[model samples]
Target: MESRPSVARPFYSTFADLYDHVVTDPVGPWTEAVEGALASRGVERGTLLDAGCGTGRHAAAFAALGHRVTLLDASAELLAVASTRCPGAPAHLGDVRDPHLPGSFDVLTCRGVLNDLLGDADRDAAVRSSARLLRPGGMLALDVRDVGRSRERTDDTPRSTTVHRDTGSAVTFTHRSRWEDGLLVVAEEHRERSPDGSVDVQEFTFRMRPWTEQEVHERLGRAGFADVVTGPGVGGRWDRLFVTAVRRA
Candidate 1:
């Protein structure tokens, strides 16, 4: 079977308003885990870059912990929400693959960003860019889909879920995913009905390339990072591969 080319809709732009509602990951625990890793490396608090900081969830958490947090994401809308959410934190609109930010930081978190880069070059560039943005011996933490686990538990069935909010608005999300050429392609549709019965529909397609543990180790090493350590999923999700590394001094 061949994969068809479709226009990539601006996902975050349309999904920003519904993000906090739909995404219920345990952000506090995830941030604490990353902070623990930093503490073990002797870093109490310093400059931190939240790369691909969607809606600044983790950024806000880091900021609340007294770290000087900086935000970066490709989506302007999401960045805006994050900026407002974490007031006083510097925000940059950029992609993690080539984040053009100023200054090397003491810590960088690129959570849930790498899998979105379906191409090898892009993924490599992202890791290298992360290294470039960190000072010598700086720490980096990120998560990606675990290729082996994900493949063993592949679910190709189409599914739908409807979420109703207390504000009298409801959104029905339908999605179908398949593996194509070793990459996961997901097609999603979101239909929202307002209190006045006005309805809006948005459709988008996204692809992800899960990484094997070996590949992650090799890539981090090639990107000028050392002391690479793979950890359990940040929020206890078995399908996620959490990793930490330090920039070579």
Candidate 2:
């Protein structure tokens, strides 16, 4: 397996405490899409692996539904919160790029993870590792923002906005776009204020490749997945694409 990248650590570590507040708003579409996929596929409950599990919000939900969940993430801080939320489930600290874990799971759920890891090689490695951990006839469900539809201008206007209700602070993020080796690189920075009147800033970048619907199908098929289905685009404004696949026996 290829060595893990450095960007994987800081992104989750620094944002762990603010993860649920930033990402899981009432209007957030990813949560709905994931739950919908599980229901549509009749995933009542079983062993599930939540790669890039973050603060374990989804893991807790899965566990609540009677699924034994293994939550894996690159950042220890994130796993700490995950552990507290789902005390009975095992929360492992590891990068998704090189997930060195044992046992196969009936379902693998990865959300808002792929876009953060740059480069096709890194992304593919993560996907392959997730696939390797799935049992035969299992399911893989993931969500990715459709960067192709995002506003790509260089202006300082907010392209992505997230509000923290607890602190009563709103963060407006801006993105700068660049084309690198047939991939669109969108760099973003979040500007937010703490409850104590302190300002915190975090920067992260993601490489979005030109992946059409056909490409997703081909790639999943190549990864030993059968019956790949591209679900409806979520996030209201076409910010995300949901995909589901089943492992072949």
Candidate 3:
């Protein structure tokens, strides 16, 4: 398995407690899209692996819908929140590249996890690993930003925004186009701000090999997936490309 440069740890270790406040609301649009994708593919209740699951929100949602859920994340702090929120579900701390996760799942969901890990080799390994975790005929659902859109933005300047609320604070960060080792690097920074004014920032960088919709289809096909579909984001353009692939039997 290929490994990528690791992202900084402060974001996961310290900022995990208040990770949700800074970003767009994921439960409504995000979850709805996930649920719709699964339903459109005829995915019914079954065992699920919430890889890179932050705080178990999606895992809890799956469980509530009658699917047995396993929540795994690289951050222990995030896993702790997941455990508290979904007591019956098992939560594990592990990297997405190699979950060391046991058993095949009926469905696998990974959101905001892929774009964080750097390096194309590592991302490819992670995708293959995710494919391996699925039982034949099972489904894998993940979200990624549309790098294509970024290239078309009018203002070439990177965008940075912050949100501070009574409950929690968050920072939204975007990096301008950068090239490394023949691969395009696009990253976003998210920091959690505490009531006392302490800040914890987590950066997620993606190394895409200039992928088009057709290229994505071909990659999924090579990964042994069938019936691949891409769709617009339920939240915003950030998650504009929602990919769903079913493991081939």
Candidate 4:
């Protein structure tokens, strides 16, 4: 058994390569839902920012649908993968909490990002930064885990999935989550088995705070957003709340 050093790498650094293996959701449904939300506001196609874009799957999907896409992520490794996936689309390395990008967009999508922020100040900063990055009347779509639904679904049981790489190696990923003070603390372990019978393991732990639809709306509204609308599981997960709001003109 080989254990990785305890030194911390950037969040998602080790997970970047294994992202697609763990998150196997097709980009089709995500793009469709985002487009549907933006289209309701008379936005067919325009500059779109995929904030916290992991591996650029959704950005690529949106670009294929004729929308100019930009990708931003804090993890350099993940941003590189996203850049490769969308060669023409500009990619930036920044945090949504205070993205300093110069361009404004007609639409923005932040999926599975806000929940990573554990503090009210950080969450509000992210929301306000998102508004600042959009042009007036631009649409913003995001999703967060529904706190109640997530708690009901979480059993605190460990689940594992294995992926076979073409290099004659296999990686097994396991995770267990528990509720703590309105936060879901997840502990993850990734074990890699080589064809030569050697094994290595890497472990990570993180916390997520799911939001109620009303709380999300209040955050957006406080950040100068208007016309907020929310739905359940637009991204194909019943435990998530999908929300859309427009930057007040």
Candidate 5:
């Protein structure tokens, strides 16, 4: 499969609205890793930019922690959702690989965005661009998966859950994910039933490339980041590869 930059935005646009509900959580494993990494680097509060900020989960968390947060994503629908998450934060509708912002940021976060590129060149461009977006001595915190570990998995993980809010309706979501051709692809079918017998079925597909920690480290180095470190992913073993690096002064 070839890397199609043309389909990246469209692929994300289809399910951008359901991002916060189904994808990332502000207090979830991702937040744990990112927040911990930021804390370790003594980044308690500063200017922060979340590149590819889907629904602004991480951006909102940082903002609540006293950091000035900015959210950026290619899909406008996602940006709209991010607006609700980080109400006053500036949301930019643009690709992270080509971000246009007013000034440099102290911390740049590119989570859950790079692996989707699934191509060496495409992800590299994003990495280089991320370094450029940061000020000297600023840090880039990003994550990827272990493609080799995912490749060995033979069965699809099936998950079913129903979530209910304080009022309105209930949403039952079924998730099915499998690995194909070095890509971890997932399909989510959501069935929402309203009170008045109204039912809506929404389907969303997502794919990410499981990248080794070494590849991520090298990419960061190529982007002029020094003292790169590949920390453990969200879970133990070769699960989530969280890479943190600082722009060389």
Candidate 6:
């Protein structure tokens, strides 16, 4: 394995406890898409691996549906949240591309992660490793950002926005974003308030590469996946792209 250049840890680790509240329906949309894909492909009930499963929401959903589930993530804090969410379900703390499992899975999922990768080599490694973790004929489902459409925006200035709300504990979110040189970069600021009026705050910056549909198809094919299919992505959003590929039998 090539040594991947170090990148800052994603927001998942920095604000794990607040993840479910901040991200809109993280698992519901993905689970629905994955279930639909599996049903269409006649795959029902099997070992499922959730790669880059930040809070284990998707894995928990599958486990609830009677499929044995395993989860992998790079963030230990996120993994802790996952373990609590899906008790008894196996979870490992590591990169999705380097999940240490004794055997391959019948189905693998990697949603909402590829676009955030900071390096091209890391992206390629993730694809190859996802392919490696699946049994021949198994399924791989994932989503990607619609980079093609994002490039349509002509604005060069960064956009800034913030949201603050109280639901038991006060929470605040600040975001600044802009597109630059084929990458969408964002600076995120988060603050959580205690009842005593004390506050915890953190800031992180992340970059996501826009991925075209054709580029996605080629990447999966190169990673040894066949019968690749693309369609509308999850979240009922026309912006993202969803794909399902089968490991070459």
Name the top lDDT candidate. 4
For candidate 2, the TM-score is 0.76
lDDT of 5 at 104: 85
**Model 6, span 57-157: residue lDDT tens:** 77888898888998788789998999999899888887765666778888998877888776878888889998888888889998877886656642445
Over 4 Å off, model 4: 4-11
Per TM-score, the best of the predicted structures is 4
lDDT of 3 by residue, 188-248 (tens): 5665566667766556665554345675577678778899987765576552478889999
For each candidate in turn, the TM-score is 0.91, 0.76, 0.76, 0.95, 0.80, 0.86
Ranking by lDDT: 4, 1, 6, 5, 3, 2
lDDT scores of the candidates, listed in order: 0.85, 0.72, 0.73, 0.87, 0.75, 0.77
The global Cα lDDT (0 to 1) of model 3 is: 0.73
- The alpha-carbon lDDT assigned to residue 125 of candidate 6 equals 88
> Mind giving the per-residue lDDT tens digits that candidate 2 earns over 123-179?
678778878999888889877655455334223344665656455765554456776
lDDT of 2 at 165: 46
The digit string of per-residue lDDT tens for model 5 on 1-249 reads: 121123343324644554555653335666667677777876555888989887777788778878899999878888888899899898898877667767888988876678778767788888888888888888888766767766775368778877654457677777777878778888766666777767776666778788887787788888899888887666454566778888988
Instruction: Write one digit per residue (lDDT tens) for candidate 4, span 89-111.
Output: 99999999988899799999999
Runs in model 5 lying further than 4 Å from the true structure: 1-19, 23-44, 152-154, 164-170, 193-204, 235-238
TM-score, prediction 4: 0.95
In model 6, what are the clashing residue pairs, if there are any? none
- Clash count list over all predictions: 0, 0, 0, 0, 1, 0
Candidate 1 lDDT tens digits, 114-191: 998887899899999999999998999988899877776668888887878677888887788888888888888877
The C-alpha local distance difference test score for the whole of candidate 6 amounts to 0.77
- Could you give the candidate ranking by TM-score, starting with the highest? 4, 1, 6, 5, 2, 3
